[model samples]
Target chain A: MAPTLGKRKRITRDELEQPSRPPSPSSASSESESDSEDVQDIFRRAFEAKFKPLEVDSKKPRVEEVNLELEDQEEEDSDWSGITSDEEEQVQVVEYSHLRHTGDRASKAEQRAFMSSKPPTLSGSTLFKTRPSTKAPADENDLTEASHLKNDVALQRLLRDSHLLSSTSTSGTSTPTLSAVGSQRHKSTDLHLLSLGAKSSIHAQKNMPMSHRIGISAKAKEREERRRAEAKENGVILEKERRAKKFTKERERGVGGPGVGKFRGGTLSLSKKDVRDITSSGGGRGGKGKGKRGRR
Target chain B: MTDETTQTLLKFTGHRHLPSRLLLSTLTGRPIRISQIRPNNVSRQGLQPHEVSFIRLLDSITNGSKIEFGMSGSTLVYRPGLITGSAEGLGASGGVLRHELGRGCEGRGVSWWIIPLCILSSFSKGHMNVIFHGEGCVTGAHPVSGDLSVDSVRTAILPLYKQFGIERDIELRVLKRSCAPSGGKSAGGEVQIVFNHQVRLPKTLHLLNPGRVKRIRGVAYAIGVGGSNNARSIESARGVLNKFVPDTYIFSDVSGAPFIQTPNDKNNPSGKKKGAVGFGLSLVAESSTGCLYSADVASPPEGGTTPEDVGRQCAYQLLEVIQQGGCVSRSAAETVFCLMAMGSEDVGRIAMGRDVIASENTIQLGRDLREFGGAGWGFRDKGEGSEEVVVSVVGRGVGNVGRKAV
Candidate 1:
């Protein structure tokens, strides 16, 4: 345990101090060369234990740190691996062409072959260094295995490329109009979603009609205007109107049913008539209406 | 008898009572013979009740005399006997005898008979007959000489007593003498006379009694002049009687004016030179007489010259006599006396005395008696024949005594 503890400390220090190295398989090949089966078994065990509940608690911090370091190395490796794969494909094509051309210059072709070959070797070396010995070949195979992994790789590349392209383009424009359009489009989509949700919620309730709800406000405004006019003409006081509204609302609640309709109809009609009569008669109808409303 | 004597006989014809006849004869100093040809009988027509009582009053003076006379023509005619005659015979003879006596004396030298008879009737009846003698004969011995005395006066007597011989006893007595003081030169005497004897006549001779005769005599002496005094003196004497006399009846001469002094101005030398000396004497005599008869008998206040007080004193005395049952008729007498007492040489005395008499005259005797006597006792003036005889008799008696004292 103490030796492992000293080794973990040395790794943390090395990780912090090192920049990055190129991928190579040689160092990692030694383990597979000597005990390929054992290395495979160990890889499976570490993978399982990393997921185990009991070990998860204990290994979460290390694993998270190693995963962050691995993710960095993988990013670098992927760049280099992409370049090498391209070179290798070019070299193979060249070699095949040269064979087909018997009259070509030998030295120029060899020079071309040496340049393309150098990229694969360098990439392969980087890949071998980061991967375990059992995964070294697989890493090379991963380069060659496009048909099987092409969609993921291409999708990832597409996402990254798009993200990068957008970021780059946005940064490049730095103009207020383009950003405003983008923000407007985002806000409109959010508002569309919110309205759709509210519509559904209201539809679920089903008690209030759209027209009634809308008209209630319009009617309130109309009644308010009428009341103000009546108050102006016959001194139909605002205090009386407020009291009538409150009483009607309370009466609707008191009946414990859909009596709001009846109450609204009665109060609205009576208050309208009262206002009309009071206005026309110059305040005479207040006495009669007040008496009737009081009794009710 | 000669016609003069025969006429004198007629004077005795009408006498109805003996005492009245005797008194008449005495006062006149004449022979008065009375006869009764018929028996005496009381006649309703002979005299009034008061007159009959008056005629009987002389009986008190004469002691007693039973005489009956018939009343003829309101005069008493002597009857034939000294007893009351029958009313039938008095009626038959009274008118003829009264006519015969009046007619027989009317024509002849015996006209003096009518004077005495008239005087007698005047006395008994409370009326009088008076004749004015001339201004009195002043004696030579009078210190101040002028027409100071009255010379002659007519005498009045009752006709029924003309035949009876009785003399009036007028004797002068010096009750007091007020001569001038020694070394002062004046000779004046105030003398008083008393009639002392009573005369008697049969009741058949005259209709009047003796008391009535005395009263009549007293009244006559009060008014008549005795010795000699002027008309002023006689008037003063009458004033004394008028103030004091109680039963006296007064009759004045028809020609005599009530004696009033003439108002003289002292500053006028002519009036002083023509002065009347007897004026002051008469006035003093009147004042002295007024004091003697004053009811209070106290001297009046010195220098207190309210003549009304003096007159009131006189009136009070007269009222006393009347209260004692006397009568007086001094209405005419007082009017005359006040007129004379107011006369003088001094204008002040005359004016003062006139004012006093005027005030005194306003005091009526009848009204005063009515007030004094109270109710039933008051004397009413009964005209001629109705007055009580005792009132006249006592009035004359007191009046005579008061005058003599003065």
Candidate 2:
């Protein structure tokens, strides 16, 4: 039990030391190696800040009182062992592919995602760690076995290779697109457009469609909408098209404004049809200035 | 009232119960004289915009109704018309036909004027298809004030009016909504109502136990301001109301151009400087028994009133009204109670009617209105210690004098 305990602690320590997989397994080996240095520092500092204190206070023996005895620990170990291997491999794939996504530098930034979930990886590693004897053979087999499987997938390999090739081909490739995506994510809301008397959502409203479907339905609709908005601004009362656009936008928003109309008292730009509807219904009477009919 | 006391009752101290007295006089064919209107005031004269507009409204509704004001404008003499609407004017649906009929309401007038007009329409000679135009009117008095007031009137008055068999034809349709004190002639409020199917009387609004306020419906309105004003007011109103009724909703009615216009902007057709931007809230609560109680509050254009303040203030006003514990909301209590004072006066009729319910506000208002109108009934309470009083009046049972004696 003591031997296994020492081995387990060593494994947990090793995992704490290294979160990024060996750079060799990833397509961007050199970049991962360079990025790993900073990432490892982050992971180490995080574990020291968050986990070491717990181990000192909890001291595995007291932890057993909470039913996490050796056998339970072994079970927990087995549990984490099974999943962490897979997580490490999948995370490698994701990191490598994304490295391919925004170019060389941003891969370093994601390496900074250690900032986001620094504590998260600490728990994942501690949840399962095996002796070096078991870990080496198993880790190698798991690494090679699963690593080959990613190669067998044409799409992932293509994406990973493409991102690598793109970055190597152009040193100036990623910063702009990456910042744009960042800005899009942080834009808070789009309610500053000065809509009067609109029943807008009080929540963080999502106006743009974030879907990645083939048709880019929202994008096309937006383009169509821009043109119509431009036309409307030019005082073009395209009633048929305006209604359609209003309905579509309203549908997307899950909130609707009082329909298009002149602000009898509100600031609405009414269509001729609305005006006609009122006049047709016998409303245009006595509207020619105030009447003094019954008054002296 | 006999000939002698009527003169004493004709005079009132201030203009508080002016509408009530005017309505009561018109209902019973009683002539009334009032004095000292805003006598102790400065800056503004005897009749504020709403009062003068109301007087003009009364003149339009009743033919030959004579309203004489003293040169100082502190005193008034009112001789009501001998009823003149005919039931034949009510279309097949017991509503006024699609005819062009309405009066004008001025800038200082609020949409609340519809209450008395609704009451009058119910009992007028012909189906009074009167239209009203006002400063807030887009086309006419089309209720652009962004309020739940008209619906509140319907809910509160329907039960009271149901007793008189004048139930079906009470239609109040908003044709246009115009925000007041802005948009000049371009924006105005307009409304048309159909009533007086046969001058059927209302049942006594006796003890219609005000059921628990099931839910509240409201409107948060802002004029010449950004849309956020309505939202902020609604949020703040909900903050206080969350204490008493969790089930409340105040829809926003933010109007005017999204951009503030400078006075000299060419788009400013009215040429008049836009008045201070305004924010207001109107709320109506419907009870379990379908009775409605309502309250309205507005921000003084330059009072530095915040959205939260308007909302909290409106909520407090509503709470004060609901606490009065009567069938009629505090705002409409006087109007309902005055009609109750002139209802079918048979003892059995009174007994069968909703128990003569009156609250502190209603009792006070009824007393003032009746005193000034020089007509009233003997009021009884369920013993002295209790504040609740049951009002009883042998109704004048006014009929249509225009019916050719048929």
Candidate 3:
């Protein structure tokens, strides 16, 4: 026991001097290494002053001390062994992901309701839950819900385009395309656009030549007039003759144009009608001016 | 109108519970004469600044109210008028009555005036939209005066109006935040109350269920301090409250101190100074049946307490309030009881905890209600070995004579 005690004392003395002896040799061997170490020491001290004292200094020294202790133990006690390289290589992973459930905190809607200037209502706790729940469990319920939604959409579309179907049926085509293919599809789309507050039908020819459009409108009027005449001769009560809607054309002007006149190739041109319209005051106007105003 | 003048004045003494007495007087349409208010205190006698500010507010909101004070300011005779809330040409501009508290009113919180005004707004003839701003408007909790923060008043007390059917278009907006100032200082906070719902009579409430606490919500605020203070308080509060209730969430609010315009002096004519700076915690526990319990704590004006202290104190206070086990907490009991007493001519039963019922303020409110010709309250045990009691109050048939014709 006395020899063991002496050996332990000697070993601790050696350990105390061991760190000092190694650093002195390294500093003597390389000046730049010593200088860099001094710089690192300064930074560590400054960091410690601002925030927390660092444990890196103590940890590195303790690791080396532990290695020395293990070496001493290996020489003294042959049966005991320290941690092996395999143990050091193995890593353990700890996870706390499951601890954070979504329900632990207030939802965004709840926050808005409570933090608002208005007094929180009694239903604030269950207000978010009262929203329309689209989530349904069970495969059977899912299938039925899907089919119901599909059928509802189909019925809505059919009801919207049912007038088109009726018009086709009157033309002796009993099978009015419920599938909405070809011409029927265009008619259905036109009806949908009208119901959504579209200004014109989808079949209306845009960017047509002036002569073609005029001829088409004239033919349509001639046909209507012929049918009206036939109905009158037969003494059958016919509907009133529908009139075509007139579109007013306002000429687009350049930003640098004269305010009340047309600009073409750096020239301001004002028609006599335009001048007369500008000069006319409230209800004091002649027949020609009035007719022109009414047309506008 | 002539009969109102001929009615005898209800006589009362002392300045204790003066605000509630004034509220009852306004509500009941009875004149009151209070004498011997702090006559013993020679240096500081008569009404305090906050109390005077409250009286001024009541005077502004009411129409035809006649007020007279004695030479020493110890005696006051008040003839309350109809509650014409924020009417034009009555100290209100642009439909908002702006009541300004002076520098002397730094001790008490702004909620001290707001809570009572809310009760008056319910029975007002017009929509009540008042903006309270001034040097002494402390939106945070008062450590010395025992007044709640404005957050608790909004989240806890104002929610009770729904039970009485006076819940429409009501809002309490905290425009500026300030904590209680130190001695002789000011807190330039701003708060607004918009109570537009006016009814002939509030619905009779029968709330007997003190349900289990489903979740806890809170607001941690820091004014003129670091944002880290709010985080600190929130962490500490959650530390204590999380063990009991798993669904606790505390929101953080940080704002700079409000600047108050001071009188011109020789050195700096454009006098401007920052108001009080502090942090506070306000916790509100909501139950399954819509019952609310609240607790408030703010750092002392002298500034020794930490944010952790305020948070822990608030958390413990909330736990104690919940442990009392009632439909309404102590801070909100006065509003709940007064509104119940002024409700429709029907019996409204509420379950209150034992300690809340036995509080001094509750007892004083009961006596004051009786003095104003309101009915007395009847108490009964809730169940066998339970700490709760069911209080039945019969409301006066005469509710809001201003609104009676409508």
Candidate 4:
């Protein structure tokens, strides 16, 4: 009876450890019987996980938490897709692990494909739709916000760390790996805050458009005004000179009439007397004149 | 004015050979041989009338040879009737007969008489009449007078003057007569002829006073020598006349010798010889009427004047007379140089023989005159031993008039 019991337990731990090795004909018959039982267990768990979607949702899947739990177990048998050929072989390997791994292999594969494809596709659509709007606000705010955000050292440090992590992870993987994913999350959060700040600064830029345009327009207007003012001053001076010349010519023409006659006559007499006195003095207006009169 | 009237008178007192040789040579154009006869050493032997006539013929012939009036044709001859028993011929006749008896007398007496007479009479009128006076002689009569054969001499000269167109105003007067005997044996008598004419002054002294007239005439007389033989003599004579008498017209012979004196020696010391008298006749042609007169007494000498001086003074008076007659105008004074021959050989050689030696002597005298300011007026020999000197006469005013004594 013990020999029969040994024959029924054909899926051994060694075979599971080296999955690539082929079984003997006697062991192959017993391993097939055990593979059927393991397959029934994977199908039942896949159905259970599928029906408990609300539970999964309630649990809030921590990708980091899941990756950490799988780290040690996956280290030895990390190649899961490689064990798909023998379900009993994979069941035997998993039985040795402590984590509750209930999903059927086929169902788990489908879930990974679905999860990976959906999140990236959705995220790409989100990036495409927000880029133009976001860029416009940022550029608008940059002039004002760059001055105001001069003291925001936290945001600056976050952007600098993200940039460094992206640079390091980009060098190791084609797609951003687990490490780059964290940096991507941080970059997204920084972008969201920058968008908020950009919107507020954009409002501030819009408020002062009239004052800036007015400053430029004011300079051109001032130059034109100065030119007009100078022309007006010149016109006034020329008009004054013309009036003076006309007065002088009228006096010389001896057309003194009305009030002008007496005024001009008196001025003329005074000027003539001055000229006569100068001439009679013989260019020595004081001493010589006195001497001549005294001698006479 | 015929050639017969133009006579050339030359006097050689002490010398005879040279004159005779010259005369013979001039006449024949050939040389002649003759014995020399000195006037101071003459003999007293008388000559025959015919012989005297022969000698007179010889004298006429010889004298005619010296007559160079520049007249045409040969000399003329004359024959006068002989003198019968005239005392004037006695001396000459006795002298010739004595010479004939002493020397060779191969020719018959008649032939001797006829030949000499014919030859003498042939040249008689043209003969130069030369008169000589010894130391003391009478005033008129002379033994040489008969020997002179005056008719023969006149005959020779008259034709000569007519041929030469020489005027007949020339007069020959006997002022004194004398001669010296041949052989130096007898005292010779003298005969003087006064030859005179109105020497018309050059037309340069028509307005001078009587005193100035005398001075100008004196200058004119001095210029008369050497007038004929050389043209320079006549020119100088005219020059002299022009100086002192600016308006007196001069009428001169072709020879230009004054009728009073020989052409040469008119100013020499020997010119002062006594019995060698000269007189003048004035012939004034006014309105085509010629007036002839003896002008000797018209102007007397100023004081203590000798005959030579008187003659010169009279010559100046004649010049005044001519000027007064209106023959010359006053403008001729400017062209004259008076005293032109005062030291010139033209004046000195006028009466000299035409010999080589005498010509040389005359050339020397001319050079001396040139050395003393040429031949201007008033030149004089200071004395016998002194050199000849010039006496300047400064003329006043324009035209060389009013000459002041300087």
State the lDDT of candidate 4 residue by residue for B112-189, as single tens digits. Answer: 222122222222222222233223222211223212112112222221222112323332222222212223122222
The count of residue-pair clashes in candidate 2 stands at: 36
Higher lDDT: candidate 2 or 4?
2
Model 4 misplaced regions, further than 4 Å: A1-296, B1-79, B82-131, B135-303, B306-316, B323-406
lDDT of 1 by residue, B1-406 (tens): 1332333422343223333344433322233344432224445333333334333323322211334454432444322112111112332232111111111111111112222232232122121111111111111111221111110001111111222222233222221121111121111222222222222221111111112212110111111121222323233333444434322222221111112122384665343221111111211111111111112111111223232333334334434433322111221212122211111211111111122223433233222222222121111233345333311101111111111322
lDDT for B34 (candidate 1): 44
Task: Give the CAPRI rating of model 2.
Answer: incorrect
Clashes of each: 82, 36, 0, 71
RMSD of each: 82.6, 29.6, 14.0, 73.8
- Off-target runs (Cα >4 Å) in candidate 1 are A1-296, B2-23, B26-131, B137-306, B326-406
lDDT of each: 0.28, 0.52, 0.84, 0.29
Worst 10 residues of 1 chain B by lDDT: B145-154
| Better candidate number, 3 or 4, judged by lDDT | 3
Worst 10 residues of 3 chain A by lDDT: A1-10
Candidate 2, residue B270: lDDT: 59
Q: What is the docking quality class of candidate 1?
A: incorrect
- Lowest summed lDDT across 10 adjacent residues in model 4 chain A is found at A116-125
Please write out the lDDT profile of model 3 over residues A222-280, one tens digit for every residue.
89889889989999888776666787677665576577666778887888877776777
Per-residue accuracy of model 2 over A140-208 as CA lDDT, tens digit each: 779898878876764543443454444534766454332223333223122222132336534434564
Better TM-score candidate (1, 3)? 3
lDDT of 1 by residue, A140-185 (tens): 5677676658777556544434543465467866433322245444
* TM-scores vs. true structure, each candidate: 0.14, 0.48, 0.65, 0.15
- Tell me the spans in candidate 3 whose CA falls farther than 4 Å from its real position: A1-110, A123-296
